[model samples]
Target: MLRLPKYLWFVRMKVNKIVELKTLYSFEAPVFDAHGTAGTSQSAELKNKLDLNSYLAPFPGETYLVKVSGESMINEGIYDGDILVVNKRDRPVDGKVVIASLNGEMAVKTYRDIHGVIYLFSANDKFLPIEIKPFWEFEIQGVVKHVIHAV
Candidate 1:
């Protein structure tokens, strides 16, 4: 599996702010052969036919396309409407931007540790840090690696 840094590549495309809703698009899957046979193929002809796969296939593994829904994360440069590249398999870490589900509600926030207490910091100070309670259910969906914005 080839893994790239979370935010390093998006800037090259002149995308600085958060990716908004209008830019969210599904990844295009690679097209397979329409008439290629899948059975025993030891012939030289079959080898040539199978080499026409597209290099533009959707990335392997499970991934989600999440649109930034709020502006509380602006300090991190994540604006409302940016598209986040969320790899669900990525582990969460301190000070890492993460998409999380809290008691069933989805949100994006920076994870911080203060005196053994985990605080979900929002950019807009008006939002409060979410204290992880004992009875609540929380899931770290993905560590946001990149943000894509519209030109």
Candidate 2:
């Protein structure tokens, strides 16, 4: 018996509502070296104000945030409850993670083009690659630029 991938059984894009960030916050914080051993942070000094808006989304009008709700992309460092920064105006390139609509369903997957054939791949092995057919209604919504998650 040939067993299919788990994603084939039920593949649905779990995403929260599209949100527009109207405010940009800037704060001053000390930068620490992760490679160095942790002992005391009293020696570290703050240099500049870190602006999240400039670092994450340079163009706020073309960017939006979406919360993930699945473990399919865990291998790619995208986990459930992580917030994804999507750029609507950015083009989806090969090997890049993108937000796409297939057959009227939205999903976040890695985009790939092999020999003219488009395939959406999941970072986790449990889910199989999804081949995009000509008959399916497909559209690339945006390209994911950054993923925000708590430590």
Candidate 3:
């Protein structure tokens, strides 16, 4: 019942090479409190450089980014054009979002195992859960570690 995007693509990231921390750009920025008073502006200085590679992909060799395009997972805050940080080395836990291949097509969905039957669920209520059949070509490519979307 999931609606896949017309064109889905995966971009494999090569993060195996080690880069010197000093060579990376320093991106320190002020942090603001979202829950602060409406008129009050409170900012705090961050002491450390924001190394995206280290923060987002600790296990660089096994991590990759996949751009998603669909409304099926909107409720989970995964909208079209969102980038999913996936770790192939991570095990797919129950209720975790994962990148999966079904019948040679790629899709992202919450993984669940109920009574030993695997099911893929969409965050949006409009779509129904997909139950995996024994004969279907299915494989879990990686577990989604983080979802990056522009505000």
After the best TM-score superposition of candidate 3, give how far the Cα of residue 88 lies from its true spot, in angstroms.
0.7
lDDT of 1 by residue, 1-151 (tens): 2222244222111222322222234444443443545564543232222211122113324355567656677778888678777667778789998887665556788878778877667766656666666566777877776766886
Model 2 scores what on Cα lDDT? 0.80
User: Which one wins by TM-score: 2 or 3?
Assistant: 2
Q: How many backbone clashes can be found in candidate 3?
A: 0
Q: Is candidate 1 or 2 superior in lDDT?
A: 2
Point to the candidate with the largest lDDT.
2
Q: lDDT of each model, Cα atoms only?
A: 0.59, 0.80, 0.71
What are the per-residue Cα lDDT tens digits for candidate 2 across 1-151?
2332455535544676679755556644545434435785545444556666777888888989988888789989999899999999998899999998776567889999999999989888877788888877788999999999999
Q: Per-prediction TM-score, please?
A: 0.58, 0.83, 0.75
* Residue 113 shift from truth in candidate 1, angstroms: 3.0
Collision pairs in model 1: 6-145, 18-82, 19-81, 19-82, 19-83, 20-81, 20-82, 72-123
> Taking the tens digit of each residue's C-alpha lDDT, what string does model 3 give over 1-151?
3433334222212122222222244444444435556666665445555556667777777887888777888888988878888888887789999888776677888999999999888888777787888877888888888888989
Task: Write out the backbone clash pairs for model 2.
Answer: none
How accurate locally is residue 71 in candidate 1, as Cα lDDT from 0 to 100?
65
